[model samples]
Target chain A: MLKSAKRFALTAALALAAGPALGGALGLGSEARPEEVTAWDIDVRPDGQGLPEGGGTVEQGEMLFQERCTACHGEFGEGAGRWPVLAGGYDTLDSDNPVKTIGSYWPHLSTVYDYIRRAMPFGDAQSLTADETYALTAYLLYLNEIVAEDFELTKENFTSIELSNESGFIPDDRPDTPGLSEREPCMTDCKPEVVIRMRARVLDVTPDTEDTSAVTSD
Target chain B: MSTSRKPQGGTTRRGFLSAAGGAALAAGAIRPAVSAGPENLPPNVPGWSRYLGSGVDAYPYGQPSSFESHVVRRNVAWLTASVESSVNFTPLHELDGIITPNGLCFERHHAGIAEVDPSDYRLMINGLVDKPMIFTLDDIKRFPRTNKIFFLECAANSGMEWRGAQLNGCQFTHGMVHCVMYTGVPLKLILEEAGLKTNAKWLMVEGADAAGMNRSVPLDKALDDCMVAFKMNGEALRPEQGYPLRLVVPGWEGNMWIKWLRRIEVGDQPWHTREETSKYTDLLENGKSRRFTWAMDCKSVITSPSPQAPLLHKGHNILSGIAWSGRGTVDRVDVTLDGGRNWRPARIDGPSFDKAVHRFYFEFDWQGESLLLQSRAIDSTGYVQPTKDELRAVRGTNSIYHNNGIQTWHVRGNGEVENVEVS
Candidate 1:
């Protein structure tokens, strides 16, 4: 107990003394080493700013996808049980039931590389090597019919591969819809009649419960 | 005040009779005798009143009364494929006021909660900076702090109801939001310490969670009101809320406010991460979609008289709900009892803060008449909340995010309420 108390006291002293150490006016944090920065700076931009050096073939990616990703993503990347369909959303962007996938809707190829490398395979993230990620990207491209099955993906040809919806995204221009103005909203008789157009109970998608008392009690 | 009139259990005569009557009714007794001499009545002291309560130190950290156990966060089983990636909603109908209790705040985790130890927590500032720097949790605390109240809303809060009302309760329809006071240092101050490079126009803020969720935030907003919050509601942030650190992008979509924040990489251009490109982007009727749509539009919902909180009282009840906007404070909330036929301004109460939830109430006398209820929020930016049809007219139902359309609740004569869409 005495030793722990002494350690706590020393920590408290160091915390107090750490206020001024860097070039900033407050100088609170220490200079980060290049290695430390590189370890966490994993984000890749559209211009291919942070693509890792690696290469892999679509054939190799098919094997990896079946082994590591098939459980949730399915063998063809169609997605299993709401786990994001990653292929064959080509012409569905304009349909009522749009199927947004990496091939159909994603604008940049770097996103696929970055996402797979940083967070993929669901529970076991950051487990893919750069080569494996490249292979998976190639396989996903094949699934979406964007590339031939024998295509090889590498850092050299990364930016050359563009998506179907590369130019599909526009900046936010809200207040574009009508009826959103500075004018005061009507207080009385805004509409002639109010009729129920839809009811949630009809579809009844809410999770069922044997007892609602616990859920409804106020 | 007379001892002779006082019955056995420290109860006044009238009080004892009323207590007995209430208990009997609750027990579903066929008929309650007013003078039945219940053992724990006013005449006979109540058991809890007579017995000693638990000692002061019984609960080191206090909790709500056991009776309130039912009020909790709930998840829809079909919402996601796995529990770790799923989202749960706050019990909005059962709560009043703007502040959501830390425990009751809605949680949206991409890869479950990251249990980060504060000692091992490090926030690195890299990329376009004069000198990249790493700050420990203690080093972060050494900086000057600021406290502010803000609402963090999921971009997909009302995304389910875009096509139509699918959720039966407000908890599911509009529960993906919460307001809390955060204590932290401004992002500008932290960036200042790092000495951002001249070309730095955007930041790729990443989380340490297993999902490694990341988003690119514009530098202007980072220098504006954004904060790196370590404490929420005056206490150390709950583990589910990013424990040692989280970014507080006031008024922006909750996804931009990265939790379990670990690094901020400055860059000259947007990274267009998976979250920004595929997930949070709003699709339109045309094949084109809207990217980088960060602001949450004006929206409001009626809490009471909703599906979970049915009306139990007939005369003189208060109608309560919450309103907020990503652009600014809610200027006013209009409540329409008979749908769009007529409307009235609900009373806006409590302290109003920028990007924070606003509490509004409307008092009325009900006489068992069926009614259609709806609320419209107008924000300081003069943006009036649009109806479901009005919103669907512009952005197609395919857009899975940012559904700020007005919500409608139907109340039957039996005091039961249901989710509905009106025309």
Candidate 2:
């Protein structure tokens, strides 16, 4: 009888919380334990909100990167094949072949630590300790000439070290373009001359159709 | 499987043509107007009519006709380092109407497909919530459900064509987008169940994939239209499309729709994750970049009469294409046949849903002259799809994503089509 009374009270609370407009909650799902939230809260913000207590040096990062990342990111973070280049490319953002690297393009240092901590080491992810991630981030900074070889990175100084392109990003201000007119779009004689500026046949970069496996073979 | 014997000396029209020789086929000679004109005519019954068909359960789950086996997703190998972390293009030229079939939706995986078992799936809501909650797949289903049709488009759909017309087919140039009807519960109900705190302004939704793909979304948008979808087109979601459950951020770039959804953390500030920073962010030519450019601009493409689907006849051709907008429904689509010399409104023939794909077509009589075909889309916002040159003038050629420029297809007199750029 006492348990039945408690259930009735819980249902009443749920209905009041949901409000009449929403028709009340169905009273599903269990309250999550503190341990469950701790296990999944891995994100780190620009203001160093979720960082753990850890520190590592650039020397340690170099060794760790060589052992775990060089196969894909290259020995000096120059990148292998189409893999991401983690270092250098400080001022190439405006050039034709803009090589955006950690030092050049990334705005906040927290992203480097978060990415390495969440998903890194290529095939293997979430396998690194906080110390290892900090070390790898410091090593990348040193490789990009942002830090000295002996510089160490810690949670306390994580926000102090800013990336070069921190001021590069702006909010989306689209429809900022010109040429779109309020008048009806041109239908007849929009351009005086029609010239073929480029053709895909000339470049011929499309994959060969013959190489594609036939679906019927399955 | 061998239900009948082969007909003696079965000389069908196609068989007769093939038996003639290579020269007859190469020169485009002796090609009948209709392939089934000979034995399959009304006077003589076709071979299939005489034979017994396959019994029930031949395929427990049905498949497309074998004749349409060529319709399949394709990928450009050199675009990425490995197949595990790459993308594939949908066979857009072969598809019609607005709904993309389940299997043909283009896939872009950061670290391959994660095969998650339904029994093991769990979605947790925590951080800044009055009461943190953990729910199994069954628990999520108990909430009120809604059905919405929305198009999920990768921001890099036309990214490769930023500089010029490089890819030969529409499949490569504009196949990174797909439309589907999703059935799921409104994310607001789930968040309300967890009871949001006053400080909750942003949400960090993370997936359970090996890449652990995550993105920060403003709480306003989450409450407006976001969904926790577990089914697509009235069926359970495909494994590649985040089986069990996935977040649906309608009208936004596809990356923000985190698949294999696992957790949602309410926060006060954006996380600035790798996807938002190191990638997805548009790099302008002036060294400044555009971050959080979420909504896909109004875009359209001529699916047929493209490089892959060339013109086969000289008269009465139906030019078909697709148009969509991330902000709202497509309002109008215009077609140009003479390199912008003349334009006419194409007939939109399907149901118009907000932030969903719209199908359009223009029927014309072709007289075998060379033609330059282009289609322009205008959305509810009156935003006209810009020309490649016009877009280049503003954003420059460096911003690889969101190249919603009008595409040009050159149709030769020989009934062959080629991807081209016009000035």
Candidate 3:
């Protein structure tokens, strides 16, 4: 018990001294080595900044995407079950039920490369090799018809590919939404008649609960 | 009333009458008797007072009363395909005060809860930095720590009510938010330790979950108030809340605060990941999508007198709710009794901290009348929470995110409350 207590005291003392010893400006962590940083730094920017040197054709990407992405992303990136649809919603953004896919709404190709490389194959993340990622990117582009079936994607030419919706997004212009910023608290007779437009219970979307009191009323 | 027989088993006429009365009291039909047999009443010693209670550490960890089991997080099962990647609502109607209890906080997980062992955890800082670094759990603790209360709200909190009044309960419509006091080291200090490069303008923060949830935060926001949090409400974060470590971007949408945080890559531009590009962006009526809409605008909701919690008594009741803003503190909360026909300022209670949930109360004497209940919150920036029609006038119904419109509840003469909309 005495030895353990002494060791605890020594540890505390060293920890207290660490802040000052490392330069007194809250220097606490160790210097990270280059290889360690390389192992985890997997992000790719929109300007093709961090694209790894690799190349793949649409044909190679077709096989890889079909084998690894078909379960959730569907046979043709239409999305099976509740998983995300990855392609083909070109002119649907203005429709009632807009299909937001990679080709339809995404603003950057770097997002595609970064997302698939860092967190794809559903549960098996970071398992895709650099070449496999390049292939999948190629296949998704082809599925969206941004590239020909024989188009080969390399780190050098990746930035040349652009999304159709690249210019579709604008920075947050909230409070710019009409009356969003200029709404004053109404005190009397805000409108002529209050109408009931919709009811969630009629839609029957919410899950049922045991408490009968929680049921929606007409 | 008689002196009574033995306080034990044998019954007289008076004893039988009192027993019947007690039974009625237990059924909630009548007010409890001032004195029940006088043996355990205030004038006499109670049973608990006479005996020794359970010893210390009886529960290594304590829990709320079993009666409070109704106070819990609930999910709309139809919202997702499976519980593993679903969202659960906090029982807001059953909660009090601004700080949501750790267990009852709303939960949103992409790949479900990742059980990360603290000993095996590592937070890597890479990309545009003078010297990239990996921080272990101990290394994180060694940094100067800070404690601040902030609200983490999902961008989809009131998404269901975007078109119109949908969910019947406040717990369902507005329960996708929770406020808690987080303990952690600031991201600025950690970045300073690594020394950011001159051109580092954005950061791609990624988590270690199965989905590897990732988002790009503007460098200004990351350096402003973002934190690498390990604890909430004075305890180690619950497994569902990103145990070991998570990022806390005050006032931003919950998705930007990545859970099970593992990597932060400094870059010159936004990564435009799936979350920021495809999901969180709000599509306008004209087909132009609003991107990088991170901050949660000012919003408020009346918790009680809602569907799940209706008026049980007619007189001297407290109408309570929560108000918050991502931009700053909630300056004022006004309650509307008869829809928007009339409005009254509510009483803001407890600590009013920046970018934190503020509790408010408005007491009213209900005269057994049918009422229309609503609340409007104005943040420190003088931004009034917009009405549903006002919001629809601009963004239209094409979007399902950032719905901070006012919510309405109809209280009937029968004392039952329901979700409703008033023009």
Stretches of candidate 2 above 4 Å error?
A: A1-24, A178-181, A210-218, B1-37
- Please give, for residues B302-412, the per-residue lDDT of candidate 1 as tens digits: 999788888876788889999999989998999989987899999999998988999999999888888899999988888899888888888889888889888999988
Candidates sorted by TM-score, best first: 2, 1, 3
Candidate 1 wrongly placed segments (more than 4 Å): A1-23, A178-182, A208-218, B1-44
**Per-model lDDT:** 0.85, 0.85, 0.83
Give residue B356's error in model 2 in angstroms: 0.3
> Candidate 3: where is the Cα deviation over 4 Å?
A1-24, A177-184, A212-218, B1-54
TM-score of each: 0.90, 0.90, 0.87
Kindly list the per-residue Cα lDDT of model 1 for residues A60-168, writing each as its tens digit.
9999999999899888999999899989877888898899999889999899988988888787898888899999989998998989988999999988998879899
Reference-based lDDT, residue B419, model 3: 84
Displacement of residue A133 (Cα, Å) in model 1 is 1.2
Q: Model 1 chain B, poorest ten-residue lDDT window?
A: B1-10
Task: Tell me which of candidates 1 and 3 scores higher on DockQ.
Answer: 1
CAPRI quality level assigned to candidate 2 from its DockQ score: acceptable
Tens digits of per-residue lDDT, candidate 3, A1-218, equal 46346545643644532121132245667777878877777778788877899988899999998799998888899988887888998898998888999999998898899888877886788899999899999999999999999999999999999999989998898775433256566667676655555555666666554332533332
RMSD of each: 8.4, 6.8, 8.4
Top candidate (DockQ) = 1
